[model samples]
Target: MTSKRRATSVTGNIGESVLPLVAKQHLGAINPLDILPLNASSTAKSPDFRVRLHPQFPAAFRNVTGLTPNIAFNYWPAESKAVDTRGNANGSVDRAIQQLGAYWFGRHSFEPNVVGYGLVCCFIYRGTRINPLQEINFHVVAPASMSAQTSLLRRVRHHAANGGRNDFLDELKTDGSQSRRQLLDV
Candidate 1:
């Protein structure tokens, strides 16, 4: 018999594959921004998706890389117990926040893009098939000085205040026990 950890890994992998496609399709319906997954290789550090600024952004928001996000995206199914494989003790949320903030800065400082705006959306779910996402938390991560890198997740005040309990990133034992066929239905 497969171990629980092994089973859980499989379920997480299934969710990892399916969620992005479902999200892109669902969220991209009104698609203001370019909805693109960050590629599987990037999952270790960066957020799952990249919602870049709309091409019309310049015309609408004065065509400048300013307060509005030149780049944005969601961190899907941010499991509370998630730990970074990079030897960091922090969970998935913290890791995503840091990587994204750094990416935002790289875009901001660079001339071709010269982006000064970004959004960090964190989703933690006790969610079921009927509600695949619950307590979806989104915060517009503003442009700060380069030195502000480490403070990424903390910048989202409510999340910081809430810690990893009850509010922001609630602990969830995801469908680790669910069969692969069952997970696919969701």
Candidate 2:
């Protein structure tokens, strides 16, 4: 009988490989996904990152009486500093990443308890044109308090450890903003 050779698979998942990096560097910071080179090509459909948080969060925000989650994330960037709108930093279908970063990243007094992980979930073709998104999508857990030092990765990890699915999706839906428009006005 002739013996046949066994073939080993050489596939890789970018999301799977990138998860740990996100958890370590961006712990508790807003928008860890933006930092990573995530793609939404045919190979990958879901967001590159996801922060699982407890359902019982937003106690403080909830107590605000009339504040809504949608309004908070969508318009808050307008009040504070805006992200880089240049073609290099802000590209099409990638503005979400910047929004996430500007919200919770470097905007806290203390660190958040969270862990992040990323990996390649799909096999990328060799020489495949990797199209960089305009604003890469960033998955993060919303923070308890707003400060300049709170780590988004740590917050997500803590939420995971503590049992929560407080995933924050950051992306840009529009192009005209106070900060971004200023650059255009110039």
Candidate 3:
């Protein structure tokens, strides 16, 4: 298979493997009826799988309440021409940002305070130039939360012409080690 296809296949296996584990661990916390394969159809944007919280979930999970879905995921293989290649992240990272952003919106809607928590998880990669993004390399899980603890508006709005802009993208273009480390810690 082509590298891209191989990468996708491997990633699929990983995702397939995780769903049951998550379902088992979450038990009452996750909505089994709606969680798996949330809107996988090609007509619109959706997560590879979503973590739909139970309706009775605690208020600690809530924020302002605009009503966005809770945590969701978008899967990308860690292999070559996928999430990373030759030890450097590739365009797939960009796609994750976009997709995860969309999922957060779909979960959050117009209300910034949705009284529910949401997070993004990325499968980390360790690779070499020879094997590129192949799974033969190590893979780690990194988490990022869009919960109220981190202001989504502020994070995305930093790019505004407002003098206070954090040069967010620039920081990313430069050495993103600090920001990346922050995500890993999440």
Candidate 2 residue runs with Cα over 4 Å from true position: 1-16, 25-45, 52-89, 92-172, 177-186
> Per-residue CA lDDT of candidate 3, range 2-103, in tens?
134344445343433444343345423333454455453464343455444444332322333323334332221111123334434434444334344444
Query: What is the Cα-based lDDT of residue 54 in candidate 2?
Result: 23
Best by lDDT: 3
Error of 2 at 143 (Å): 11
Worst 10 residues of 3 by lDDT: 73-82
Candidate 1 matches the true fold with a TM-score of 0.37
Q: Would you give me the overall lDDT of model 3? A: 0.36
Q: Give the winner by lDDT: 2 or 3.
A: 3
- Total clashing pairs for each candidate: 1, 63, 13
lDDT of each: 0.34, 0.29, 0.36
Q: After superposition, how far is residue 102 of candidate 1 from its true place, in Å?
A: 3.7
> lDDT per residue, candidate 1, 43-145, as tens digits?
3344455554434233323322233333333322111122212122224444444454334333333322322233344444343344443343433433343
Candidate 1's displacement at residue 148, Å, is: 9.7
Best first by lDDT, ranked? 3, 1, 2
